[model samples]
Target: MLRKAFMRVFSAHPIETIAACTGLFMIVLGVALGTQHGWVWFWGQVSAVFGASLATLAVVWTVRMRTTETRVAANIDVLARQLETSISQIHKSVKSGRDEQLPPSVYLAQLEQCIDNLIGVSHELGEITGRPMPYDVIEMMTTRHTLQIEAHLAEGKPAPERRLVTETDSCPSCKQTVEFQIGNQPGDSAKPTCEHCGQRFHAHRSTSGSIFLRLPGASQFTRAVSVSCPVCASKIPANIDQAKQHSEARFCFSCGAKVSIDPVSHACTLISKQDKLAGRFDAAGVFHCEKCGEPASVLTSNINGTFGICRKDDALVVLPAAAAQGSPKTDAA
Candidate 1:
């Protein structure tokens, strides 16, 4: 126990113990010499002790500076390596067109994080050493990385409005390549009839990846049917259920014309707004549009409640049966 305690005290305060021992030895020597030679010998010994203490402190400070410098350099190296690895991974992803692994937004976010780390390391290195930091290489790498990302985004973009895609498909019957119109979105397919053969397919595709299939018989009709506007020749899309319910009206997208279609013939016709409004009820009674002044044969009971009337320009007018009483007659345009 005494040996262990002596070892701990010696390790903890070796410098203080050595100084105390030297001072004690000098005091004993001074006493011996004072009986003979004197005060000059004692003063010289004190000066030597003070110089040794200052030299020991200088050595400790130098060692601390060296240890700190080495650690900072190591940290800078680690950060640089990490940043490089991140950049390489991003470059590989862009090259392989494997951006699905991470979305562009996520990729950009990671790149930003790496750039921040690189910037922090550069700043720390600058603070540690007064030398000019080599951040130009980092700046160049960042610029190049940014350009690559932008290029990938540009490549993913759709064709310009002016540069229309000529959708080429061969007709099943005629086997002739037909180029479709310009405005359809990507993957928009249709069982378009061949202009030469008048052949049509049972299935079709819309811009939003919706499939429209022609029904086999009377009970079920095609969900979405594309028709042309009689007045403007522009395409109009209609849903069969909406046409039957009369709750929703289909109108021409190009011209402000009311459009109706024969489900069997798929014949599109332009009708007056008054005719469209009047078509919303059963034929048991006559009804009139107070705003348009056109009369329609309808069931009074069906229309006695408030009816939502869809007009030519997509405006909805809610009307009650009492508004149908007497109105100025107007002709269809």
Candidate 2:
């Protein structure tokens, strides 16, 4: 216990402890000799020892303060150099990104790297200054940049095939199925008024390309539907809410055929085979040359169906299918 107490006090104030102990030892020696040397001599010795102890303490404290200041200044210099290096690296990265025509995704990734470097510097600064780093601005900047990149990428790509289809959603107020027409564009939106309750609701495309209807302070919902591909007979999953205000094109995954869905009739029609490039049938049931847009005459009929063939300038066009019946027939050359 004694040793622990002594160590605690000595570790906290070693110079003061040593000085005080030396003075106490001298006083004790003086007390022992006071009986022979008298009280006046003992008091004189005590004053001298006390003054010396105070002088020693002052000198030690000044030296310690100077040493601590020097160490802190050295640390600060090292930290300053490190910070300069980090900033230089950040500038180089920014310049490189500006000089190169990088894709939006690549540019955003580099920007994120720069942000991470800045965050590291912020952490270092916080450690030195004992203050919390303000990260809200950084977060906001990151989010803004990410959104801009996303918008740029979206605009660069071709718009998805748009088709008008009827969508059904339950009205929050009336609890009845509300039917409306919408486009299949992924981000397209509409405002629909409920017929049953006259309540207005906001409708928009979800990330999965389905139409979602939502009322104020209410959850969103969608109507699911499935259709079979006319060419391959494979089931195609779709959301009715994704139908557009006009006819749009869709590709069948199973047979690679471009299929068109009638918005009003909900019928799937074969447009063209994606791989074959054999041309498409028009709305009027007339087969046309894929390259020249000229109506192709039926070259022959078979058990499969009627095949149309046409010549565009020097190129001969062969269509995969012809009108069901009454198509113009041509003699084989």
Candidate 3:
């Protein structure tokens, strides 16, 4: 309480305090020189000493004011840099779509704290120097923060569960079961690859199961026609990535027929077939001739030496096993 009162008075009457101190010092000097000097000389000496003391006080006050200004300016610069860095980080998080690193609420809290500190420093600087600080960046960040908060609040509500649509189909080339997951979007199709033959295809069907068809061309073509081999009438798999390089004509394994496709109309036509391409199944072990589409027991090994047949056309075919050969390891998924 006493210190506050003293400070209040000191700030209020600084000139008066300096004048009193100078007057007291002048009087002491006059008394010391009274024996040698007359009253007129004493008065002259007192005036000179008082003027010197006032000059010294003026110099000291100027130095202290300059020092205070320097420190305040440095502090403001530091605060401005900190504010810039914080805003840059916020902009990066928004730009790169990496906001998941920090949740919206948590990031908002951090930005609010930084803005508060910046505003406080700006206010202090404005009051001390009587100059307005540039706060356009702060205002922009505050506006963005407000918009983000509103978006979060509006979208944060719970939503109803959507019915999941799934379709299961068999691959025409390998007869592998292919399951597709259709999302809630309208006209959306699922592209599933066959694990058995590595063939990829898109499955599009209505919820009512009324419209079901395999796209004739690649995925890029808006128009699709149902494709079947002219000889064996087997379905074929093709996609955009495959069509870009070249149109792949499918060879029917069931009938040993070479197929050709019309790129514009997506029509399938059997070009030719060699009888020698078909191989007869004589062995007991399962054999899969992709060219002949022969159904036999599953072959366990990929090495032809284990169990394989050479065609009359001198073509060696590597077949995948359809099932395990009564082995525990082969049966494990």
Best by TM-score: 2
Candidate 3 wrongly placed segments (more than 4 Å): 1-40, 98-114, 131-145, 151-333
Clashes of each: 1, 6, 3
| lDDT against true structure, model 1 | 0.44
Candidate with the greatest lDDT versus the true structure: 2
Which lDDT value does model 2 have at 81? 69
lDDT of each residue in 1-333, candidate 2, tens digit only: 999998986786677777667766665666555555667676757755775676577557757866887886776675566457546655654563355322222333434434444554555456567786665332433353454345345325333456877788777567798898776644456678999889987666543345545565422211223478888899754333222343444555445566776554567888776543354445433456677788654332223343343434222234332333333322111
| Local lDDT at 25 for model 3 | 69
Looking at model 1, residue 291 earns an lDDT score of: 52
Q: How many clashing pairs in candidate 3?
A: 3
Write down the TM-score of every candidate.
Answer: 0.29, 0.30, 0.29
Judge candidate 3 at residue 166 and give its lDDT.
67
- Model 1 C-alpha lDDT per residue in residues 112-156, reported as the tens digit of each score: 434444544454456557555555322423353454344345335
Query: After aligning candidate 1 to the native by TM-score, how far in Å is the CA of 322 from where it should be?
Result: 64
Weakest ten-residue segment in model 2 by summed lDDT: 324-333
lDDT of each: 0.44, 0.53, 0.46
